[model samples]
Every structure is written in structure tokens, then in C-alpha cells.
Target: MQPKDWQKDFPVAEPQPFTQPHELPGPYGPPLIGHLLQISSEQSHLTLERWAERYGSLFQIRLGRSRLVVVSDHKVIQRILEQRPQSFRRNCVIEDRFSEIGINGLFTAEGEDWRRQRRTVVAALSRTRLASFFPRLKATTARLQRRWEGAADGNQLVDVCRDLTRFTVDVTMQLAFGVDPNTLETPGPVIQRHLEKIGPGLQRRFFTLFPYWRLIRLPPDRALDRAVKALDREVEVIIRATREHMAAHPGHGPTNFLEAMLMIAEHEGSNLTSADLLAHTSQLLLAGEDTTAYTMSWIVHYFTRFPEAFARIRREVDDLIAPAAALDKLEQANHLPFLDAFCNEVMRLKPVAPHMALETLEDTEILGCLMPKGTKLFVLLRYAATREEHFAGGDCFDPERWLPQPAGHGNQPHNTQAFVPFGAGPRICPGQHLAMLEIRAVLAMLCRNFDLRPVSHGKEVKEKMAVVMRPDHLHLRLKRRSLASSVPTCAPTAMAASRSGASHDL
Candidate 1:
């Protein structure tokens, strides 16, 4: 069904106020465990989506001893999301787990604290600021291209996820702190090694019914502790170095997020502390890496499945940026409408964050069901995105739906609200602008310089849950384009270091 036709069948309904919480529709599960075992699997979002199909838009599902109100309705979810920090906040368990690992910053903060920290973060990643950081980002992309070039030349299989992680780590470290740990070229005891352990550890604890790690230190738990301590030591060194730079220059202004945050904390009458700065810094580092890396990885996965889209992007990139190997200007990244549309489709199909967990701060009535205070709500972001009721052939990977059509064409409108990949409303991911720029730069560069061929079979590729959803065991082979120019041979280490001091001229 087309989007215009599906809306007539499924209209966004107003609250009925007649239904109660216990009266909602759901599946019957085993006595004590409820749906814990099935939902605790790595593909929990898929499980919730399947249940959404069976039980209608809204349903109640119990995981272990706790009952959660699962919602797949986008309109309802939007209404609830807009009331954040006041009417609803992130589930306390999420904050508790993140706080335990020392990463509970802007992502998990609430009320006034969230407001203050968000200002600093928004300033750091703002589009104006991102433009100034483009040279560093471009240099990082050039390094990744070099890595792929070597792989293509040797006919070696490229671990797409691992390489993309390195790309993001290199880009993020420079932006987060004014330092370059170019993991793409140098492979040693860097920040990426420690960051790799943090995501899985957090995910393991999030789904576990009880906090067993606190009582007994398992191998993984001990490793997590060591990773945290090591990461803290690294961050402490960065803080000391930044302070010394500031003291020596005296005339120089804050250059990076860490510097900006440190300056804020040092300001008189500011409420933020050293611990708060550390948490927010770690938050940006982790937040910047996985989402964008997994997104590009999924784009590559789709390119292998749909070669026509790959050709289309390559043609677009070739026309737009032919002489240059990769995008040089920040504005050039914005001009590729087709590449942007293609990314929109990829995100719609495989959102890194498929669901967002929140808790009600006050008793609320949604649709017809009354949710009491402290009730857990699972908003299925990807569920409604794939439903035919909101999109035309929603399950399929089609990019044209996101593009503009002639007026007389069958009116297949795109519902932007239904697809909340980065989430919606005030607390939406602040890094979205940065993520999109990074995606455009890297993918455009890939299409321009190489052809992606899948190394793993379709069935062999799995979606494993970590800090965010990622393509597990995904491998690809890149063949350098014959007609395309050779990849840039600039030394990224020097480029990054020279540009490190040249931050956004805010």
C-alpha cells in the first residue's frame, strides 16, 4: 500500500480514557520468568516487533518480575517524548548502570543538570562548530581510504566494523579532546581497546535480571573494572595536558569539547564539577563512535544487497566530486540529496537504537490505557518505521520514498515523525549533525574510490547487541575504482596534529 492509502486505514487516534493498565492486550508467558528469556536475546528489538505485530500497537509484556508497557505507536510515543525531564525521564535502571560505569553524563542526566550539560554539548557539536572541524574529519577519512586501498591491493578481506570503529575513534578523540590517536594506522594500546570493553559490559548488565556483578566479580566484570580504570587514567592525562596548554597560552581560547567543558567548570558560580566533566567527556567519546560506525557498516551491507543503490551513489559522488578523492568542503557533504536519501532509508531499516526505555514521572493516560507513575515504557522506534500503515512498502529498502516526486505522482508522503532513528523531541541525540556529516564524508569517499563486495554471506551476517546494535562478523572486500583518482597519500598524523589547535572559531 502507498503511504497516502495506508493512513486512511490507520489513523492516529486520540486518547479514549476508558482502558486501564491491566486491561491492555499482550502475550501470556511462563509463570515467574514471563518473557524474560526470549526478550533478553541479542535481537530483543525483533522480538518486541514480532509481539507488536501479534498484540496490536500497544501491549504489556513482563520481563522477569517487572511489567513493561510496550508501545509501537509513533504518535503516542512522540506525545510522551516531548514531555521529557518533567513528565517522563529515562528509566532509573539505565542511569544506575551507566553511573556505575562512570558514563552517566548528558545521556542519563535529568532536570537542571541535563539542561546545563546539554548547552555545553550542543555548543561543542553544533553545525557551525562542525564546519571548523571538517579538515580533521576529512583527514581521518583519507586515512581510512588508505587502509581500504591497501586491503584492495592485497585482495585481503576487510573487517568493515572494526575499520569503521577505528575511523570513528580517530575522529572522535580529536573532536572530544584536542589529541589524535590515529588507530587506523597505528595499532597499539589506544583508547579504542578500552572503549571496546565498555559497551558490551553495559549491555550485559542492562538485560540481566539482577546485579550479580556487584556480588561476585566475574571475568568480564573484572575486565570492565580494569578498562574503566585505564580509561580514567588516560582521561586524567588529557585533562592535565589541556590545563597546561591553557595556562601557557593564556590568550588561547577553548579548542575542543574537553576544553570547553573544563572552562565551564572553572568558571565562577558554575555548578558543574570535575566528575561531571569527566562523565560528559566519556559520554561523547562513546556516543560518537558506535552509532555512526554501525550506520556506515549497515550502509555497506545494503550496498552489497542492492547494487543499484551503490551505482546510484557512485554516480552521484562522481558527478559532484570527481577531481578530489574525497569531500574537501563541509558544504559539499550537504549537497548530495540522493546520498542523504539513501542514508535515510538505511537508518529506517536498521536503526542502531531500535527502542528507547523511559519511565513515567506521573500517572498518565496514553491512547486508552492508564499508566501509573514509575511504569516502564518501551518505545519501539523501528517497529512503526517498518509497518505498511505509515510507509509505502515499508519493509523494503527503497530510497526514493525519501526523495521528492512530481505533484501528480501517487502522493507517497514521508512521515518524518514515524521514523525516530536518533529519537525525537528535546532530548534527541545531540550528535546527529556530527553523525550525518561523518556518514556522508566516509560513504561518499567509499563510493568514489572503491566497490564494496560482501565477504560474509547474507545469513552469516548477524545483528549483535552491544552498547548499540551492530552488524556482527561483517566483512567486505574493496576493489579500487579504475577510473577514480588514487587515494590521497597525506600523512594523517601530521594533518590531524596541525589541525588539532585550529578548532571551530566560535
Candidate 2:
């Protein structure tokens, strides 16, 4: 359908009070529009938390003409995500915007199509495959270290998030397309621009008082359309290059993820056309890049905020690689207790994907409340994570909360349902393991090399939720640490040293 006709078909509905008997009540707005304008403009999770406290955990808010059910109860979210995958698909706004640039990959695909794509992508991102890809990850980390060194020397206040985004984008591009776009050194192509643009656009659509069909047609800006076209063109180029390479070489090179997909197409005697390839590649890039980078950035932010935790991590890195001169010893740094706790705490406090939207496929009852088919549900993950009832000192940035108590000690796994940073269910993030590895490795190196402090007024850095929960601006003053002071005098393993090259020295 053409964009205009599509808009007409999905006409904006007049807002009304939620009619369902089981729906929890929320503050309503004027006729034909609901609480959407209020909810979207303010912090959503905070708004939902307040409503839950007032009404209950499963409250209804009118999103345009649509009724959205927001749920923070762990049991309810788990059941919806795990037991009712079919009943809950991607929310309408996400599905529509992502589709514009051909994003029907595992993350957004549904039913049998989702299952097939997920199976192939998951297999490729499996533990064994990730281990093989470690060398590439390590290489990228090395390059990042060089970048950091240059920044430190120039006394630049680096936006750690942007740098990490570039690094992950580079890695995802290499892993998925076998082509290094080198976005780390330069601004990304049109697709990259769209990747950034589409996120805020989707967020706006989600919160808008009008349906997306109406919103997109009204000419505020054609930036979104332009971005979509740019993304499409970039993906098209990659698809064409892959096809040419396969036709010319035909079974000559080691099979990568793209090659594996192509092989499946060839064996099935199906022409897995360029569009399919473009869509899947776009999916892979979107899935792999933003979440990982955001997670890494959050970890750094938390480390800087909680200096004790930061100091402990630095000490752990030092102990793991006793000899400051031996970079190989850094491998042992991965096993440090404090480092693990710090990363977990960072995820708990600032989950990268704080809110996930799911749609109900059929009538279902959650927590004794009946939800009709096609209901939109917002899974409030970060609010769940930080609830006072979920953790002792829940609002405090304490890494020790994640650590195990000594044999006779008191701390046990705090039973909480709010900690689902990666989401829950059969459709949980497939790239989680790889993401953890990247985060842990990069964070380990960062602590070992730099004495990082937030900018003088940086303590006020508030998080603004976009596609990910990211700090609006993270300005860190990095002082390169002396190797001898940071690490012990012990000899390190060759691998660790090679990875933490002289670039670490400011």
C-alpha cells in the first residue's frame, strides 16, 4: 500500500475511557485523546510506577484511540513473554517503523517466520561460534584502546557512549557483512544515520497522541523517509556485494553468518532475493549494535558514579595481572569477583533495554485480569529492577548486592522478579552472551588503564530513554593510570598483554 492509503486505512480512533472490566483505572485526559500525551512527554516508567502504586500493577492508559496495558508484576511479565509468545508480538509502532527499512529480522519477525530466522541467527551466535569470534572482538577492543589513548592525551572530554556505539557498530558490521565500514574513524553512512534517527522517531510514535499512520503522513519533516531510503540503499549495496562474491568464489571461503544464510537459500533451491538479505542484515546490525554499546556505556557510567566499586574493580584488575608489564595476565582479570558484581549492578540499575512492547495475539488472563486479543502491553523492566520491594537498598549503587556471602555469611540471592534486563521468555535476546563478553572485556581494560571521573558537574547526568536507556550526556575526565601503579609486578600471559598494548599508556 502507498503511504497515504496506508494512513487512511489506519485512521486515528477517538480516545475513550478503557472499557474492559478487568482493566485497572488510570488518570484520563480530554475526549478523543487519552493519557498518552501526558505519559509520552513525561518519564513513562516513573508514570507507570506512580499509577501502579495508586491503582495497581496492571493499569490501562489510552494511547491515542488504543488502550495500552502497562504491567510491572514479574509473574505477569514472565507469563506473557514466555508462555504466550504467540499472543504477544512486537507492538504496532515498532513493527511499522522497523518495516520501513526492512527490519524483519529475528527481533521483529513473528510466528513461523520469526522462528526460522531466530533459529538461524541464534545458531550462528551460539557459544562455540562466539568463542571463535573472540579474536575479532579482541582486535576491536585494541583499536578502541588506541582511540582512548589519543583522547586522553588531547585532554578531551569523551562521550563514552558515542565511542562505544561506533566500536560495536564496527564489530557488528564486520561479523554480519564481512565488510568493515570503519565507522569508528568516520561518521557512518546513510543507513547509520537512519539507525539513529528511526529510534527517536519510533519513541515519538509510541508516545504520540495520534496513531503512527496519521503522524507519518503529516509533514513535520521528511527526515525519517530520507533515513529509511539511505538505510535501504546501504543494505542493498551489501546485498549486491555478497551476491557477487558468492557467485564468483562459490564455496572457496570460510563460511560466515551471511554465507550460512545464503547457503540455506541455495540448498533449498530458493532465490533468497536481495531484499531478504537486506532485511536480515539490517536486523542483525540493529540487534547487535545499540544494545551492546548502551550496556557498555551504562557500565562505565555506574563505575564512575560509585567510586568505591570503581576502586575495587581497579584493585581486582591489578591483582589479576600482578605484573604491570605483563599484559597477558589481564586474561585472569575476567574472573574477578568485584568486576562481575559491578557489571551486574550496572545492568540492574540502568538496563539498556528498559521497556519492551508486546502485543496480545489472543484473549488471555494475566494475574486474574482478562486481556483481550490485540491489546498493547508495555513491559516496564527498569522500574521493576529498581523497586524498593525488589532489593535491599534498591536505589543505592552497591555492587556487593550481587555478590555471594561467605560460607557462614548472610547474603543470599535476593529473590526479585524485577531483574530482566535482557527481557524474559523463549524470545530473550540471542546475542546476550556475546554482549556480556564485550562488556566485561572492555570494562576490564578501561578500569586497568584509566582513572575515570565524571565531569565536575556530571553527577547530574540524568537518563533519557530512547530505544535504549542512555545518559543524555556522559562526559568523563580520563586520567591515564600508571601501569606500575595499576598492576602488580608479576609477568602476564601473552594474550592479555597483546590485547592491552602500549595504547593503554597515555
Candidate 3:
């Protein structure tokens, strides 16, 4: 059978109410697989938004034999994620796969394990630590600049997604394992192939809810097993080298994140095991690389689509590093208001993780709705971000929405909960600060060095949901912009600039 054919075999049912009429807003699902078919199809986010329009913000859908509550309302999401964290836990099916591989990292772990891991990560990724890592961030951005310059030298229409992926992978590898994957100069096929495979595997596991699938497990694919072994062996080598170095120089250690984890492992006096260290390090590599890279791709895509935003970003960069020779001043050049707003706007529209899943640990009442224990919940983050009620010009890419206004000014109400690109609640992404720093630095450099425009023949990039939200086949043409020109040649036309103030352009 073809991969998606099984979806057709599942029985579909009519929508029913899972809770009282006045409690939650929408109709529930049918017996087995309710609205699962509708949601699992292509561009599910848009489909969910349409459903939200029909059935209210909070609704229910059935996936195979499982029931899932879809929450798009900001108040309900905040309450569930923050006010009642104990009532919700990471989805078991998703967590179990990671636990099986000795990876009880924060993303997959639960309860005390999750809390400890989060605390450790938060300490390592705090604002102070991120500031300390600026030198490394600058170095990676420099490498990407060189690559972009070379690519544009031949006037080639390059895949910005591919370039961003390589750059992010290189930066993440260095930060996590202190090993340069050389994805920029020489891409590592082993790492790239395995990273791609992991996402599909995860998605398949997420879709399969029956316990029998795990019980009647078939033999593992030999090629995939071999790739896993190779990756594990590489990680082991790095761990061993780090241990040997720490022992030889005791107290004098590397300044990178991996070394910091090692120090924590020692200080914890047996609570932090070797497996824990390896798992956290690997998690960092996985989470850090693709998410940020995809975000940068979307940022570039938006800039191309809305050239006024691009021009604003370029102007910000130019002002920060005038004379175009202030390479050393890059670290101190992050105060650009428009650049910050632009990044926030991109995140608002194209959140890297579009859907976040949580499972109920106990029966609970949310906004007067009684939810049964074991019911899975998927917060439709992207849909919430695009709703007209939350954003003034819902579909348009407007950076000005994030700008701070004068006190008591009756502008559009700013709703941060509706824009959860890095997530909300105590379980929010710990690496958020580091990720933002990396994105801001790379985007700042790109805007300064080159003029980004969409490829004439390439299709307009739209959201493609994987482990991260990425642009599907985002091909962009780069024109090398000269700092010598007082008026940037690639600045948007007057009409294009004015359109950003309009509603629903996206």
C-alpha cells in the first residue's frame, strides 16, 4: 500500500460535542478517526484555520482510536500550558521514542526529569551565557557571508533554504559537540541523511496510535541502523575526547556548551549520568540546527516578498556598521528596532514548531469544559497567529505590530500568547535566547551584504510542516548590494512599501 493510502481505510465520523454546550466552543469528532483525515492532509494549518472559522476556537478531532482537543484560543492555551502544567504532560507516544534511544532530554522527558533538564539548559542558555557565545556566533555568520558572496559572484539563483540549513548545522554542531560538521565547506552526508530520516520517522510514529504497532515490531532497517550506529560512534568519540581533555587539565576546561554540560555532570555527583550528557548534547544539536535555519529561510522569504521590510533591515544594518568595514562592531549592533520587529513578524507568521502536543494527566475542566484524562491536545499555534482577532492585519507581514507604542495609546492590542514561536509556559524552549541571537546576527549580516529577491521562475514559498515549519523549495536570487550607494538600489517601490500597511496581503 502507498504511504497515505492507509488514511483512507480509517472510518470517518460526524462531529459531536465532547463537553457541555456553554463550556468549550465546538463540535467533537466521530467514533474512531474523526477530523484526523481533514487535519493530516496537506497544508493542515490553513485547514485548521478554516475549521476554527466554522466551529469556534476550541474544538475536538479524533486521530485513529485517539481523541485530540484542538485549542486555538489564547486564554485557554495560556491556562493549559501555564496555570495547569501539572494536569498536562508531554504526549507519551512522542516521549517514548526518544526515551527508547536513551534520550530523556527536556523536549521529550516529563515530570522531575524534564524539570531538571530544563533548569540545566536554562542556566546554560541564559542571557549571560548567550553574550559569552557572541564570538562563536560572529564566526559562523562570517562563514555564511563568505559562502553567500561566492554564490552570488556567479549570479546564481540559490536555494536560500539549503544555504541556511548548512550554515545553521555548522553553527549548532560547533556549539553542541564542539565538532565542526563542515556543512558549509564540505557537507557531511551521514549527518544530513540521518537528520532528514529522523523527521519522517518521528511523523510516522506520531500518526500510529495503536499499541499493536509497537508490539508487532518488524526488524529494524539495516541501512538505517547502520546510519544510527555511525552517528552514535561519532558522538561517542567527541564525548571521549572531551573527558580526556578535562581530566588532563582539570579545572581548566573548554568554554563551549558541551564542556559546560560536562562540568554540570561532575558537579551533580551521580545525578547527571553519561547517557544524560549525551542525550542533552544531541538534543541541542537537533533542536538548534534545523529550527533556526528554517526560521532564517522564512525571514529571507518574507524580506523578498515585502521588500520594504528588507530595505528597513538594510538601513538598520547600514547605520550600525557604516563605512562597511566595522566587522568587529557586529556584536554591539543588535539594537535595531525595525530588525527586531521584522524577526518577530517572521516568527509570528511562520513559527518553527507550528503544532505543540500535550496529553492530559488527569481529568480537568478548562473554561468550564470537562476534559477526560488521556485526551491528547494539539495547540494550533500557526492558526492562532493568523487569526484576525489576534492580529490587526491578520494575513499581512507587518513588523510594526511588534513595535512598542506610547502609554495609553489605543492601538491594536498586543497579544504575545497568540504568537508562540518559541512556545509559552514553563516548558518554553530554553535555547530561545541563543536561537534569537543567532538569527538576528545572521539576518543582520545578510541584509547588509546582499540584496535578496525571489527567483523569477521559482514558486512563491509557502509553509511546509516537518519537525520545523520551512519554506518548500524557496529559491531566491541574490544581488550584491554596494555600500557606496547612498540610496539602496533594491529598495521597494512606493506602492510596495505602502502595501505593508494594508490588511491581509499574505
Candidate with best lDDT: 1
lDDT of 1 by residue, 1-506 (tens): 11112223335563344466567888887877788787764778888889988987788887777788888888878877888888889988889998997877888899998998888788888888888899999999999999999999999999888889889988888987888878899866677788888888888787777788889989989988988888788777777888898888886677788888778777755776667667777888888898889999998888888898888777777777776888988877766767777888888889999988898887776666677788898899988888887777889888877666557754564567788888878998888888888999999899988887887665587778786889887898888887535333332211111111111111
| lDDT over C-alpha atoms for residue 61 of model 2 | 77
Residue 334, candidate 3: alpha-carbon lDDT: 47
Put the candidates in TM-score order, highest first: 1, 2, 3
Best prediction by TM-score? 1
Off by over 4 Å in 3: 1-31, 187-190, 209-227, 267-275, 325-327, 330-333, 404-409, 456-458, 486-506
Clashing pairs in 1: none
Would you list the clashing residue pairs of candidate 3?
Answer: 16-28
After superposition of all CA atoms, the RMSD between model 2 and the true structure is 8.3
lDDT of 2 by residue, 1-506 (tens): 11112112223232222336234666765666877667753267667767776766667777667778877776567666785456678786687767754666777788887887787887777777766677777777777777788889999888877788788877877766777776666644524556776566555656765555544464423665666678778777877787789999986653467877887888888777778777787878877887888888888878776788788777767767555322243244356666766777778778877777888787765544556777788877777667666666776887766665457544433544567778778888888777777776688778778889688463676666666667767888787878766645454322221111101110
TM-score of each: 0.90, 0.86, 0.83
Q: How many angstroms is residue 181 displaced in model 1 relative to the true structure, after the best TM-score fit?
A: 1.2
lDDT tens digits, residue span 1-506, model 3: 11112112322232342353234454455667655656653356666667777877667666777666776766667666773357788778777766555545668877777776676667766777666666776877888788778878988778776788777777777765667777666743646555655554445456543534446544433343454556566677888888887888887854666787788768876577777777777767777777888888888888887887787777766666654522344344446667777877888888878777887777665443456677688777777777777787787887877665556644575566577787778887777767777777788778777877677464656776665667887887777778687343443322212112211111
In order, the Cα lDDT scores of the candidates are 0.80, 0.68, 0.67
Q: Model 2 compared with the native: what TM-score?
A: 0.86
How many pairs of residues collide in each model?
0, 12, 1
